[model samples]
Target: MAEEEQCNQFKKYQDYFEKQSDLMKKYDETLFDRWLHGEKGVIDQPPQHQGERRCIDFNCCHSEMDSTYSMYCQTSRVPYCHQHYSYTRYLQPPILCTSNPGINITTKFVHTSINKNKTPVYCMRWTPDGRRIVTGNEKGEFTFWNGLQFNFACLSGAHDTAVRCMTWSHSGGHMVSGEQGSNGSSSIIYWNPSLAPVVTLKTAHSELIREVSFSPNDLRFASCSDDKTIGIWDFNKQVCEIRFDESENAVYSVDWHPTESLLLSSSKGKVRIWDPRLKEKVGMFSPHKTEINKVRWNKNGKWFLTCSKDFKIILHDIRMFNKPLMIFEKHMKDVTIVNWHPIQEDFFVSGGANGVIYFWDTEHSKPIGEIPVAHDGAIWDLQWHPVGHLLASCAHDQTTKFWSRDRCGDSLEIKKYQGTNRDYDPIIPMYDDDLEQPYLAPVFIPNQINPSRINGFHDI
Candidate 1:
């Protein structure tokens, strides 16, 4: 009888795995590791098996060889044994996750301050004056910085959750931040160094808010959220003046035209235009073919840029309102954000989920250069240095990198000047300053294969 009972129990275990065998073939161990560590949420009740079923981890102290164990991965929803559960405790970095095949940079980023205290940075913006920067983090904290120093006035619990969006007014002295709601409630928190909750608009949206923008005049602000509605708020009253309900899909980004009364929003693969003065839809643009991630009004506010999850960047002339002036498709992953160079009208930069930052010449619709591994993970936000060609980028890697123009290399030399002339010299012999040397020539790397070096000539 005892032998028969043991055989039946073993048979049931075999049956359970047999039923899941097909899906098991598609299971990825790396993905399983992410899910087990709570890196990804695959199911609602992912803690582990409950009740008399006991822990699925065979390493459990109370576990016996004959004990029953079962648990499901929330992401894969696949039943896994408990012993496999404790495997994460003795974590080994996967060999596959470490190798990064990327462009060997002739130009590289200079990693600056690493904010270890805050949760990963989500959004960032620079004051119009460019003297100060404000960053919002996943921990719902607001960190203000000047130069490389952290300000003493960092605001804690500014949002109670990740601050997904931040806007610094063009003329006003205040900043507005939007947070992802833990519940169905979302709010906007306005702050200045001196005041806490200078003004708080609670329950500003019915769901998590994705972005917020203060108008050019700072008299009004606009917000978009997962609730599929856009809210226009009156700054003085601290109340929503009106809401646009045209989009059935959640709005991801919104930007107020720099000099006009118009506002632009990206949602449901559509570009929406709203006339805040009249509180009505003025016009709409449909250049994007997928959900848009970000929209930005150029310096003059005449042209705008929009990037989408479809990996396309479209430049729209606000006056035309119907067609994209340029369509850029250099990104390999869904794009996160786009920013215009403060001084160079034709120059713009974009970052994507793959951690590549591309510098583009909008007039040509092609990438002029790139930072191959700007971040190890997706970049969340990018801000151009207010005065120079330096760019500030924040990413999922928990670091903010400041990239500067490589004045002596790559972009300026390789493509701009070199072209196809391997023999092109910076200084002509007639214009040579040094009479003894005539002109400077590139030094051939010692013992290295130099395609540009003449092997027959040897070394004079």
Candidate 2:
């Protein structure tokens, strides 16, 4: 019965596949169909060209296989059959976080969970209780890892294609995930704590889904996609309450304000702010010179960060939308992901395409500490642990890593103003004449009111 259902799902999209471009048709002929047909394990394919490197799998005679079907272990740099390569890659030592305490916080290497199928982890988040880390992967599956031991717990298939994005409600009562539209259909699946799908919204987007974010109240969530639309959904109704189609280009990322009704979506170089109450865009600004890959709101929602292909990360204050609060541009490659410290709002970390992870303090423009090498490939996602002592990152290298506090007994904590709940010093101090000036207030001169402003409105 299950096989029949799977075939029906495949057949439903058959016409869409048939209408694809010639390049896509070639992919369908070579690999796509076989993968969806439940073909698993190391595949043997005809070599496209002769190469010196051969599979290093024990006693395996398959040599010079097509590079598309075989890959070398990122750490070992030795070729292996797909199966053995995944095994070896996951066994490689964790990359440690090396840093000099600027704000007195740093991270060290922790254990990693192995994906036996070599399914690259695309998105991950710690359960609200911080007991387990759930990862959505390229295989449309979810793998749960024990938070303490950092070992695999279980796996569940959730989609028919890549699980592109996912988010957990603030209370952990609900979990939602979105998928790539490889079969001309994308879906959003709401799950229970046990990893069982409770509600499935098929064809949620016309193109690949980029992100799904839950509001702070958890009453509603938002999803954005390459279809150039954002959907506001009410999970109780399992329907899209509103669809935003103002973006002129493909939307790559979306995030809900941690404590507000505002929704943020990034398309090309611009970020637009939408208020669900208004059902229209309230503000839009171009923060980067190129495509912005990700945008995240701080827990307080008063500040947010955006990283882009321009190799820069900008911090913006919600009140001051016209200008950035700080611009951090130390990354040598395109910065892929930025995660704020769960407890220390003044500090955050970023991972780059060159595999370098940087620790930054908003008070300074430079990175305080860094992991010169965090992965063998570009980092796809990053999430700080709930309490802020640990960090988790996944990358194109086909592995997920954990990092924890590096030192045991140091006073590795930042101090903020007394009698205040804020996590940062609200005022910037200036250094002048060997003395720190807490305030350098700008002088202002009053100007006469415009005579044209009669009682209220101005007319052309």
Candidate 3:
């Protein structure tokens, strides 16, 4: 019986081997067919598998196998296992917009900041082309900045004391600056940007120089001081040709007529017009309740404007001196500076001690717009760009700001040509290199006097 049982077991093993061989053959044949037709097939018999070689640590169940192990896998899928990868997310950055507001929109404060140096900036002006800006500080420092860069490129010592006032010549080739000394010695220095003063005109003014302006026509320029004198200089001769001392108080402001050969000055609540050619006063008007602080002539030269410490703007017709054609009051505090638009005759701006700037239209007594808190401290000076719609202002807080009129009309256009760069083509060439020589005589003026008199009767 034992022999019979052993023989039966051997036969059973043989039968199992045959069955496995047949299954292997069938599986190989099915895989070959699926590969040819690009289809998948299922396996029926379970094959004997060896235990995997694992890492030394029993906690690790992953097998250490050759990189080629992936090639023998039945499935073509691969899995990645990282905590950060499973929870990954993505986002896009935000965009910024800097579009300007419309014209009808009210005046808006674009920016404001206090200068850290604490040195008061007295005067500020943009370059003729509007590419750069220049500022004078009370610490006797002058800084030049390319507006786009927003950083100063050139800084130099401009004077021993504070630089009181500055004006660019019509040609934009040079600039003139006035320095107020502590010892009551005020001097005007002409700068060529390449060398020292081409012309230095010293005055006997015992106080600070208040105002300086270049003539519309290129023959001369004017400067006024607290010494109560207005000095007119001949540009060619580089000397003071006429001095007017009609004010008991200091002459605070002076402006040149745009078309005529006339000059206007304000001092001690009085406004006086002078004919430099004849060296005599032509008109005098006192319509201010308080001290006159500033005077400005319209671009058309038909009228002039004056502002006062009484918070009023008086529009004076050159022909009508007894009464202002229009008187407008907008500021609650003293009006410190008034500037007319370079091209528009109807519009002007005024700044006050309350750090407010008002834009006015003479046709209407009310202000078109106003900027409150335009500066931290009192606004000392304000100026308009010669061509564009930019306004520059200085403050006692040692900061200067630039403002642009909110004109958003599609019809607004700027056309620039190569030859159109020269605005004022002098009938004669003027340059600093020719300063060593003497100046020729100015164009002769006809001696004609108007019949209008201040006392209502002509003395002549």
Candidate 4:
């Protein structure tokens, strides 16, 4: 019985071996036939043009080829290839500040984000928390964007005319905007973030408003106009408490002292410092041969800086009231705008019609650095970011640029828009048939000159 059982077990093993051999033969035949006929099931063919090595694994299909490999195959026409890819390199600009080290100016700058728009940007300001940015444009529109997402969170019409100037209340609860019209309907409007104007002060001016600024305390604000007057308004009372009419030309700019209860106005060619509490001009500084375009106070309020069409920037010590402590005369064209660094009181920036910007350090009495081609055309305005070391500039080229204060080497064109478009072609030259020498005596040809008639037309 034992012998019979052993023999049966051996037969069972032999039958199992035969079955395995048959299965192997069938799989080999099927694979061979498929390879020969090029009919493998849905082969993720290794993409042609992979420059070097081709993947041949049955499960690893060519459909998973990288973008570089696909592009290489399409452009090079190489079949079933793979190669190491190289990345394009860029030279980055300098960074202004970094936490790894204390304040240093030579760090590498990486552009974190960019915001674009279709309308020309007039002004930009960051909210107190630095989470949102507000921008005013020539279309009389105001837009707010969250700094991270670059999404427009709110849009509203802040003025009927072009919104020429804007200022945020110190409390960050609302903003004040001045427009370019002077009717009763054209008044300074104050609006909250909800797109609603909560206070509209209708103290009329005879011409367009040029500038508006909020006091450091936020309880008061000032607006100047081509009417040659500056109106100081009380926010709580919503009334023009004082009107300064000392300027002979339009008041172009106004700035409040950092700590004092004084206001400064630049108009014509003079800078006037006014005491709002006393409601009178405390002092006047006339150091420019042309119009004074901008005035900015230092962080400590002990001194202020002014720039003018004379291509000069003057630093004035408020206590002396005699002459400027320093004069920057390096600009080649009109100095259109100036701004003081928010963190460094002695450092400032100036922009000009020459499309250049000067980074000035007051202590050194010279420009620390210069950026040429800052704008495509004349720069109209500039402001420093309240917290970060960034500066914003706008120009007639219909673009706004941002520069790093800590890193003067880096700059970025932030936004661009179309300016006014006008047509000039006509059917024909209008003056083609008109007399060309009517304003001058015909060159007196010796024979054609009638001396007797010349005396009668002497007035011509």
Summarize candidate 4's per-residue lDDT along 356-382 as a digit string, tens digits: 777766754556455666666677777
Which candidate leads in TM-score? 2
Structural RMSD, model 4 = 26.8
Error of 3 at 17 (Å): 76
Q: 2 or 3, which is superior by TM-score?
A: 2
lDDT of 1 by residue, 231-334 (tens): 99998899899999865788988888888888888896888889988989888767777889998898788899999999999888887868779998879999
Off by over 4 Å in 1: 1-108, 145-155, 193-196, 409-460
Per-residue lDDT of 282 in model 2: 96
How are the candidates ranked when ordered by lDDT, highest leading? 2, 1, 3, 4
TM-score of each: 0.65, 0.67, 0.63, 0.62
lDDT of 3 by residue, 87-193 (tens): 11110000000011112111322223234456788877767765667788898677775544334457777877888888888787778888776676887888874
Clashes of each: 8, 0, 0, 9
Q: What is the C-alpha lDDT profile of model 2 across 58-120, one tens digit per residue?
A: 111122222312232222122211222222222111111111122224345555566989867
Any residue pairs clashing in model 2, and if so which? none
